[model samples]
Target: MGNVILRYINLMVVTLLILSFFSFSLAYLFPGHPIENLTGIRLENISQIENTEFNYSSGESLLVQYWHYMGSLFDGNWGVSFNSGLPLYDEITNVLPASIELSAYALFISIFVGIPLGFLAAMKHHKLTDYSLLSISVLGYSIPVFWLALLVILIFSLQLGWFPLSGRISLYYEIPDITGFIMLDIFLSDIDNKEAAINNVIRHSILPTFSIALVTTTLIIRITRRSVIETMNTEFIHAAYARGLSGRQVLVQHGIRNALMPIFPLLAMQFTTLLTNAMIVETIFSWPGIGNWLIQAIYHQDYPAIRAGMLAVSALVVIFTMSIDLTIRLMDPKRRRLKRAAI
Candidate 1:
């Protein structure tokens, strides 16, 4: 296991280096540099354009500049935002919790709702209930996130006036930032109406969370249903039934556990997917998250911020996925046996 982990870490390192280089190159090659965005001036004459003030390392070549950029990254400096003149690292950290909170909530909703629905569908396989859920899942997965988000906002915020239109929380309640998550912050705050504050946060979060989780939940349902059905058809499940075990007992004890083993790694991958999709959801909901921040950085052609954002997100995905893979191996006895045999 140790050797396997080491090998995976080595692979992650190589992959990150490749990802960083390409991402850095793409940011650098963007049509308008940060200088243009900051000064509202374009250098039409390439030959005459020297890095006099913008700090492109005027005396050094492109390779040297990139080398210095990589060095700075290692030194925990992501440079400054072209528009705000603040450190890119600070900006990323400041906005990261919003994205994390949003993604985590969406995943929680997906798992809790999806797994049981999937189990029921599998239990009632080839029946009307199964077909109905399958259809719903398919439709949910097919609907575009941005469109769904907008539609929900229209119904809930505009037409119905049930929820707020945009923003994380109402400006009326100034919840102190305890954990960077508004809900948690509200919970932690010394407010007169603690329950009301938390409820407000939940109400504000519902549309965006639901919209983002719709597709993810459907996908989970589909995967889980298929896995459970496959497990049910296996000989071990039949053997458990032969032992005079109740159907529910067999399913709860043996079937669901076996079925869910394959789903963990997939869940890990979904974390990154949710994070990427948050870019659109956050924009639509006007939620303050790293994804929205990155969009603004791109619009302003903040190359340093762009590069840093991409690398940070990529690193997070890679590390998280690898950790899940390791967890999956540890959780499944069959995987442990295989690893032992391979070793």
Candidate 2:
């Protein structure tokens, strides 16, 4: 166990380092002068550009600039955002909670709906239920996120008037500053006014959450169905049935566990993909999240914000991947043994 933990930590560190390097390289590749754009103080003379103290001045070498950037990162200075006139960290903190909340809700929907549906489909293989689920899964995967989000808005918000069209909360409600997560803050706030706060959060979250959930649900169902079907056909599954195990016992104890093992890794990758996909949804809904912030930063050539956002997203991906790997290693004896030997 100790060896496995150490190996996991080492892998996480290496993955984070690689992601950091990649982010830095990508940021460096961003066209235009970041410092000038951020400061809004342009130098007409090339000599002035060279003489500026704020510019990369450790040395005129590329290696020196790379080291300087890394050093700045270590010092907790991610740079300044041109658009908001705030530090990159502050801007990220302001928007990150919303994105995290949206993603978490979407993932919850995916896991809850997808797993049971997939299990049913697998159990009823070659029957009407399976076919119907497979068709829905295919359609779900086929539709683009932005289009789906729009369609959802049209139906739920405009047509039925069942949910709010955009934003994280209603403008009328005054929420006390707490955790920044609306749902959590609502629950944590004064109990007498909780109903209004809860209603405000649910009302605002319904549409965007549904839109994101739909996309994730489709992906999860497909992966889960495939994994379950494959697990069902394994020799051990048949052996379990031969041993007079109850259908429910075999399905839950053996089948679902094995099926879900493979799904965990995909979940991590999907999370990162979801972050990128959320950009269009956030824009359409006018949600104050990192996705919309990133789009605006790109449009305005706000290099600092863009770089910071990209790095933050990359870091999240790396962290999620490392977590998934460690989880798999801990759960799977074979993986744990391999990791131990490698260590």
lDDT top scorer: 1
Q: List the residue pairs that clash in candidate 2.
A: none
lDDT tens string, model 1, 150-262?
A: 99999999999999999988888888777787877776788898888878888988999999899999999998899989999999999999999999899889998899998
Off by over 4 Å in 2: 1-4, 26-28, 34-38, 45-51, 339-343
Task: Single out the weakest 10-residue window by summed lDDT for candidate 2.
Answer: 53-62
lDDT of each: 0.83, 0.80
How many backbone clashes are present in model 1?
Answer: 0
Give the 10-residue window scoring lowest on summed lDDT in candidate 1: 32-41
- Report lDDT (Cα) of residue 341, candidate 2: 51
Whole-structure CA lDDT of model 1:
0.83
RMSD of each: 3.2, 2.6
lDDT, residue 246, model 1: 100
Which lDDT tens digits does candidate 2 get at residues 1-343? 7777777788778877777777667654765564464355586787777666346542356577667777888777888877777888878877888898888878888889988898888889899999999999889888888988899899988999998889888777777767778788777877577887688787887778777877788888888888998998999999999999998999878987888888887877778767766767898899988999999998888877887788887787778777877777688876666734563
